[model samples]
Target: MKLTIFDCDGVLVNSEEIYLAAELEFLESIGAGFERKAYMQSFMGLSPGMWEAKLQTCVEAKTGAPLPRDFYAQIDRISTVRLEADLAEIPFARQGINKIAILRCVASSTPSTRLRWKLQHVGLIDLFDPHIFSGDLVANGKPAPDLFLHAATAMNALPHECVVVEDSVNGVIAGKAAGMRVIGFTAGNHCSADHGESLLRSGADIIVENYDDLAAAIERFARPH
Candidate 1:
């Protein structure tokens, strides 16, 4: 049996814009103004810890002011509120998941608590609970292969028998490094104009823009060569 690994934020839920909105607001509050397009292209797949560090450096660079250590917490609080007010699932996620015949689980960079909360909020917890894996459990996040490899091991599957469905460059890179097949997903609102091309260059084996195509992609991958 093949193991299918999913990325939560942009691939399963329509929450990328929620984080972007929260971050953009926080940056504006601190005197930084970044275009949404640039932000998504540069940082769509970073873990919160990494993003916080990057944002701290950015705030200091842009405004010539030391960023408060509490900035990350503040953004997390804001993000929670925004997500609760406006969380949505990708249009065809349920239908697609119902069609897939392989074993699947989520492996995300999101902290375990937030990951559980968000998936529960969207009613997707049942689909992946007990099998949810977080990068928080590892020393490194995506683009490093730790999280995916960990999930594969937990599921008793080998790297070559796994297929990663992701929407970000870092995730695809990590999947490739882990020796798994990678499918780039671009149906989310956060996808850039060149999202597919970027995902491919970063090492995705294929790109699927919607869940219907995702089902087909998986079936195609499962066939013997």
Candidate 2:
């Protein structure tokens, strides 16, 4: 049997932009300003703890002060409001996923509570709920093989029997490191012009621009080589 692993933020929902905007706003407010591109390259797809640590490091370097104690709460407030007002699934996600027959689960950097909340909010929880895996479940996040390995093991799938669909370079690296074939997803609003190239360099087996092509990509990967 084959298993498909999906990254939640950009692959299933267009929520990456919401989180990034809130983070940038909070950072600038605290004088911990960051360039958009640099921030994306450095921190996207990281587990919450790692992301926060990196932001604190940036804040210290820029302002000689640590991030405020309420930094996460504030960002959470901002993002929660935005998410309630306007959370959208990636285009074609619902239709594509409903039609696909592969066994699948979510493996995301988002914490368990927030991950379930976001998926439920977008009406996708039923699709992958009991199978969802969060970054906090493992020792390391993206760019490390731990999370994907954990997910695969829990789902009874060998690494080689999995196909990971991810939108970030770090996620792709982790998938490949776990010995799974990966499909780089670039249909999210947050994807940059060269995002596909970045994923390729990081070892993605294929790049899919929309969920429509994702099923085909997985099928192609599943064919005997």
Which segments of model 2 are wrong by more than 4 Å? Answer: none
lDDT of 2 by residue, 1-225 (tens): 389999999899989988888888888887787898778878889888888787778788999887788878988899989988889889888888886678999999998998999899888989997999999899898889899999999999999999999988889989999999999899999998888888898899888888777787888887887
Task: Give the distance in Å from residue 194's predicted Cα in candidate 1 to where it truly belongs.
Answer: 2.2
Candidate 1 contains a number of clashing pairs equal to: 0
Residue lDDT tens for model 1, 80-153 = 88899999888888889878899999999999998888899888889987999987999988778999999999
In candidate 1, position 27 carries an lDDT of 82
| TM-score of candidate 2 to 2 decimals | 0.94
Cα-based lDDT at residue 99, candidate 2? 68
Pairs of residues at least 3 apart in sequence or in different chains that clash in candidate 2: none
How many pairs collide in each candidate, listed in order?
A: 0, 0
Candidate 1 residue-wise lDDT at 211: 88
The 10 consecutive residues of candidate 1 with the worst lDDT sum are: 36-45
